[model samples]
Target: MVRRRFPVLLLHIFSMFAGTAGNTQEILYPFGPEHRDLETPKMDDGSSAEITLSISFVYFNIPYRTVYVNNNGVISFNVQVSQFTPEAFPLSDSRSFIAPLWADVHNGIRGDVYYRESTEPELLEKATQDVRKYFKNMPAFTATWVFITTWHQVTFYGGSQTTPVRFKCILLLNLA
Candidate 1:
């Protein structure tokens, strides 16, 4: 019954030291969020107009997918109609002449869709065709018509993984 607790205490300390020596320490490098600084482009100081239309189609290849699509885009139509008319009216004239004028078409990317593997190209083709058809039926105009189509590829955290998607934007402008 003599003091025998000294040996037990020493053994506990030695075991803890041995355990720590064999374990490996890991070093972690944490990253902060990324920032993008962009400047706004100079826009024309004129009135803005917009026209929206709905497109519907049935794809036999992908019957289960959506059949109705809403195609929309921005319209920039800035032209002087009074100058081309027989009588040039003053700017103060409240009664403006309405005639077919020039139109500048600009297409913008709207939304993103993630599709299954090997289906992106087919889906994109189908969507593009449908958009073209919708615009072809628009009323004829006199000025140059620009059609802008935007496609975006977004990656999270700048990683290699990407979601396959297609977006079609159509802008139709008619002046009377």
Candidate 2:
């Protein structure tokens, strides 16, 4: 009886912990507007009318990994930023908004990157090479505004069998 109860207790605890994971949320920050035009115009009474026009642009980021499972059960790597939320971040400061930004990966404000590796000894080398090559020449990172943004839930897709995996969300700021 004692032995049987121990496994049941452990199972209950594991299930409870897993259930809490669904409570977390991921938020995406979209960019803001760009100041377009600002000029002083003549009023109907021949007085100077100040007309200040401001236009803003927002950019969003969507990153996803695509895996191609071959006949031998190898997962090919394809990591990329699916889309940029706001096309551009505009400001009147005469500075480039191309600077690096930060994001939360684990449902936090600071985003992180998701990385994983399998335990299969034969596949270990291939997985390492794939990840290294993927990171070697990644696309340019853009600033993602946290406010006035949208978010998409992260879900697992592809691969009928769920293998051991790890994930990370990285906050990338524009360096330039």
Candidate 3:
């Protein structure tokens, strides 16, 4: 298959390719006290202290047990990324990250970032249902690990007041 931008966002359960199945909107997962919150201003160009994953998450078939959740909507496996602007795909650099919506963002002035790793029964069930609904071939998939990073009500960095953005990346690792 062609190398495409990561597909299948859990938001409203839609693939990156819209119009293929009339997927136009993104419906994010509901956040509550369950997720760990990231501090602001401090997290403007910063990232969360490294988190040891409850279970290793394999990306590109490489197993990783640690990660840094950056304020700019990315879950990084290498060093935390503070670059506001996003590089094109097939990058020349070696930064490893899963960007749900990487951009010049700052939670310092306004907004919040939250993250968590869970295997909660309810969450797992929801994740499994979502994956099956979007990726039809994975009808029997059941998530054993779930990682979520959310940037909510965040403003732009080095700019005047801008529209607040709310987005999230939910990674479901089916270790079954």
Model 3 clash pairs are 11-27, 12-27, 41-108
Off by over 4 Å in 1: 1-144, 155-160
Candidate 2 lDDT tens digits, 58-140? 22332212322111111122312222232354533332222122111111212112222123333333333433445565333
Candidate 1 residues 79-169, lDDT tens each?
2221212334343653222211212211122122111111234333433344344546522322111122221221212223222122223
lDDT of each: 0.21, 0.21, 0.69
Error of 1 at 57 (Å): 27
Candidate topping lDDT: 3
Tens-place lDDT digits, model 3, residues 1-176: 55222223353222232332342223556564544444423456778888888776777767778989888767789688888788888668887878877778788777777777778898788888889888999886887768777676676786444455666788887754
**Candidate 2 vs candidate 3, TM-score winner:** 3
TM-score of predicted model 3? 0.79
Query: What's the count of clashing pairs in each model shown?
Result: 1, 39, 3
Error of 1 at 170 (Å): 2.8
Between candidates 1 and 2, name the one with more favorable TM-score: 1
**What's the TM for model 2?**
0.15
Cα-lDDT of candidate 1: 0.21
